[model samples]
Target: MYRYDEFDATLVAERVAQFRGQVNRRLSGELTEDQFKPLRLMNGVYLQLHAYMLRVAIPYGTLTSQKMRKLAHIARKYDKGYGHLTTRQNIQFNWPALVDVPDILDELAEVEMHAIQTSGNCIRNTTSDQYAGATAEEVEDPRPYAEMIRQWSTFHPEFSYLPRKFKIAVTAADRDRAAVKFHDIGLRIHKNDAGEVGFEVYVGGGLGRTPFVGPTIREFLPKEYLLSYLEAILRVYNQQGRRDNKFKARIKILVNSEGVDGFANLVETEWNQIKNSGVDLPREEIDRIHAYFASPKFENLSGESKTHKAKIAEDKEFARWARTNLAEHKTSGYSIVNISVKPIGGIPGDISDIQMEAVADIAERFSFDEMCVTHEQNLVLPHVKKDDLFAVWSALKAVDLATANIGLVSDIIACPGLDYCSLANTRSIPIAQRIAERFSDFQKQEDLGELKIKISGCINACGHHHAGHIGILGVDKKGEEFYQITLGGSGAEDAAIGEIAGRGFSSDQVVDAVEKLVDYYKNNRQDKERFLDTYRRLGAQPFKEALYDAA
Candidate 1:
């Protein structure tokens, strides 16, 4: 929703020109592949197993219908007819030709989008809750702060090349929809006892080979010092973080090695010197950014819509979708509708060009021309009027985007594993597809209830396997692909890293193992307990026994 000013536009244009020159040099043989590797990565271009992949940033997961149309155009013209939405709320074009990357970047720049800082060891796209401004539970919208961090960190000379990649997430809601605790720096916006707005800062949270739920470093930091505090954290990490071993280069490793108190003291010492510096955000600037995220106009209406109720009564399909895919909105008579990209047997986050265009049209016609890319690999019309729900559902159904499986077993989150990623050990998409097909029945999925299954092709954990209720990790064992399972992981406010079950399962046995665990839970759960609640209550022992020890 934030438009680029002349400075922002000029900066992006210059970067595009630079990248175009770089691409031309590589193509012309002036630069070898070795020489162009860093350059390409800096521009969010990666040479995958099969082709070049381009990742475009969608800041804080917010986009206009116009921007969505531009993405659809790029998917149609430059890459394959589809784009993959990543766990970070960015989109990936997996098959862009090396020569056409500049053109793709040019198209993206026209819509104030780019792939800058999407892949390199600098601060990646700053993400927030998809329903930041529209939800009633949040103390305030977190997007403004996320945007401010984005503007400050883009091409910051000090942090351009850290020991490892950095990520920051912000959340203002009571629920942690953005997985803030799993980020390098997580900021939770809250009001103090005196009613003044501030942040609760968490440091050193990340997931990879070594996963950690970041510890709270500061209980209350005033909003004005956010930039200064972040700078302090980065400075500490840059100076102390490991550079010799890439495996242990993350800030989480440093924090763990030095203990949370030691790290916090270092950050405090650094912050003391720069707390009042010019980097501290001025009140006017904060207000200006906040204004850009102000709520859209809504017609006065009752909390419940008669037409919506009537439509649900009339259409069973619409009623099911409403129950599974809709969230309560702050504005009365308006609901947040989640469009699940994970249809049964389909790739978890892949959206075709036609589907993208259809969604754009639907957002423009019914959701006031704005949409959000969620961390759960779904699109959201955050302000759809309740009265217009049925029409929107019909339109989405026409494009095959009306899957009513938001948090069900079929709505999986997975990475472009061995199918696309060069670093992957085994295929992830097929496993996800098979699992979805296994639980294809909507009634069966509803019966399963709020089950999150996340899979990663490797230990990179790009699919956020560590945070799922059922986490599956693919591994290479003597040139064969196998999967390891973990249970009871969560990414909400009470974040916890999942504990692994006993032995690995071959690809053929993995899906059946998952099914067995689900069935065990269904048979053993009390009342309406979700899979995660049951797992936590009974611990992983029972599930592990059911998965491996059962005859």
Candidate 2:
């Protein structure tokens, strides 16, 4: 919800002009692909398998109807008719022409959006919980802090080139909807016994070839000192993180090499040196940023709406959607509504231009003219009144966006794998679609209960498979596409990496294997237990047997 100031507008405008020149130079044959690669990446352009992909940053996953409309227009006129919402809460235009990228960026700049820091080895977009201001269970909305970090990290001279691409996530709630545990730097804003707001910081957590839950580097970092402490962590990683090999360049790798205690000690030493050296955001700037995020004015409706209850009683489809896709709102008579982009066999994170416009219109009319993109690749209307849920549901269904499968088996997180990415060994979207279709039944998915199925094309873990209750990683087995399954991983407060079940499955056998695991969970789970709980209690052995013995 932060608006661009003069400085922001000027900076973005200047960058667009600069990139336009660069693109012209490339088209004129003054630069080769190798020469132009880093330059384009700096502007969030990627050379995918078939075409150039343009990733636009959605800082902290916040969007306005105006911005959404701009995005839909871009999708319609510039690239394909759709955009892919990524796991990092950014949107990717997958089929843009190289020649038209500058024009695309110009359109983006019109909406106060850009692609800076969305790619490259620098600090990428800082993601936060989608329900930042609307949720009831947060200590404070973490978006302002995330915005503060975004401003600080945009083009910091020292960290412009990190050892690897770095990620940071912020969350204010006990339930980790932002997957903070899997980020390089994860900050949970909370209050101590005295009720002073501060961040519980974790460092070196990431998912990829090597996945690990970050260790708590600081138990309680004072709210004002957040920036300084974060700089300290990045400073240590910049100085110590491996750079010789891209595979081992992540901060998590460095943290694992040095013991957690030793790593924390290094960060502490760095902090002692720079904690008060004027590195923190100015107090006025902090207040200015916080002011933009002031809560929306709400009517004095103090209780739940009878209209909502009546609708749920009358409409089973609406009721089903309410059960899975809605979160408790901090304000009475309001709900945080999730718009799942995943249908029965649809691509996981894709939305057509028409769908985008429809959701934008829905957000504008029903919500407070605000929309959000979740880290799990879904849209959100963060402040919808409960009374409007039925209308919203009806509109969404008409646009084919009403999928009552948030957090269910069909609500999967999958990356565009071999179909798009040049780095993938196997296709992921098809697998995700197949798996979703396999468990397409809404009642059956509800029976399965809170199962997370994540599929990544490669070890890079773009889909965050390592953090799923059922994680599937695609790999090349000779010439065939094989999936390695892992169980019990989570991105919640009780974060843990999933353990691998023995032997990879071919694409043909993968869905059946997943079904077998679900079946075993259904049969063996204790009263009302979820897949993760059952897997944790019994370990991966039972699931492993279920998958392979049946095969």
Candidate 3:
């Protein structure tokens, strides 16, 4: 909902022109592929397994109706007829020709959108809670602060190219929907004992070949000092982080090598120098940025609309969809609706061009023309009225978007694995599809309760397998694909990395292995306990015994 100012418009236009020239040079053979690699990466272009992939940044995952339509247009006009929503709250078109990328940028810039800073070692898109403004229990909206960081980090001279890419996430809700603990920097906005608003800062969390749940360096940083503190942290990492080996170049590696206390001391030393050097935003500027994220006007209505209840009673199918898809809203008589992109046995996070256009229309009509993409690979209608639930469900069903499997086993988060990614070890999409089909029964999924299954093609952790209740990572053995499973990881308020169960399974054996894990959980869980709760209460021993001992 934030409109591009004159400065923003000019910056994007200029970047596109510059990238166009760079693309032409590579195409003309004036610059070799080695020479063009870094230049193209800076503009959000990547050389994937099949072709070039253009990752367009959707800052904070927020999109207007017009912007959403343009995305559909790009998918239809350019490469394939679909786009992949990634774990970082951005979208990737996996098969764009190198020549057409600049034209794609030209199209995106028309809608005030671009792919700049979406790649490279610079601070990537700053993600936040998808339901920031619409949720009922948020301490405050986190988008304004996320926007502040985005503006500060964009093309920042000091930290543009770190030892490795850096990521930051923000959350203001009671629950950690943004996966704050698994980011390079996670900011949770909260109130102090004296009613002052500030942030709880977690640093050095990341997932890849090596994974760690970041440590909390500062328990409470005053909101005004946010930028200065971030600057200090980046300064420490930029100066001391490892660059000799790409594997150990992340801030997480640096944080662990220095020890948590040692890293905190270093950051403190840096903070003392520039905490008052005008690095932070002024109060008036903060207010101006926040005004763009103000809540829309709502008509006061009582909770639990009678019309919604009546429709639920009249339509059993509608009631079933509502049970899983609708969430509580801060405004009375409204709901936060999640449209799961993971249709039964379909590819996870892949939405077709027509589906995209349909979602745009639904948001335009029922949800204040505002929608957001979730890190779980779903589209959210953040401000839908309770009385309009039936109509929204109908529209979604018409486009095959009503899946009723939000948080169920079939609602998977999978990267475009061997099918698309050059770095993949196995085909993750097929494994996800098999699992979804095995658990395709709606009643079975409902009985299984809140289960999150995340599958990654490799150790890059693009699918966030490290944080799943049941995690699967693909590996290579004897020229064959295999999968490794982990249990009891979470990305919520109580964040923790998952523990590996045991040995790996073949591509054919992986789905059965996942089912066995679910079966163990379902058979042994206490009353109303989730899979994570059951796994935590009991240890990995029980699940491991159920899996390998049976084999």
Which regions of candidate 1 are displaced past 4 Å? none
**Model 2 C-alpha lDDT per residue in residues 380-483, reported as the tens digit of each score:** 99998888889999999999999999999999999899999999989999999999998888999998889999999999898889999999999999989999
lDDT for every model?
A: 0.93, 0.92, 0.92
**Candidate 1, pairs of clashing residues:** none
In candidate 2, which residue ranges exceed 4 Å CA deviation? none
Cα lDDT tens digits for candidate 1, 115-204: 999988899999999998899999998999999999999999999999999999999987999999999999999998999989999999
Q: Give per-model CA RMSD.
A: 0.9, 0.9, 0.8
Q: Count the backbone clashes (under 3 Å) in each candidate.
A: 0, 0, 0
Q: Top lDDT: which candidate number?
A: 1
Which scores greater on lDDT, model 1 or model 2? 1
What's the lDDT for residue 62 in model 3? 94
TM-scores for all predictions: 0.99, 0.99, 0.99
TM-score of candidate 1 on Cα atoms, chains taken together: 0.99
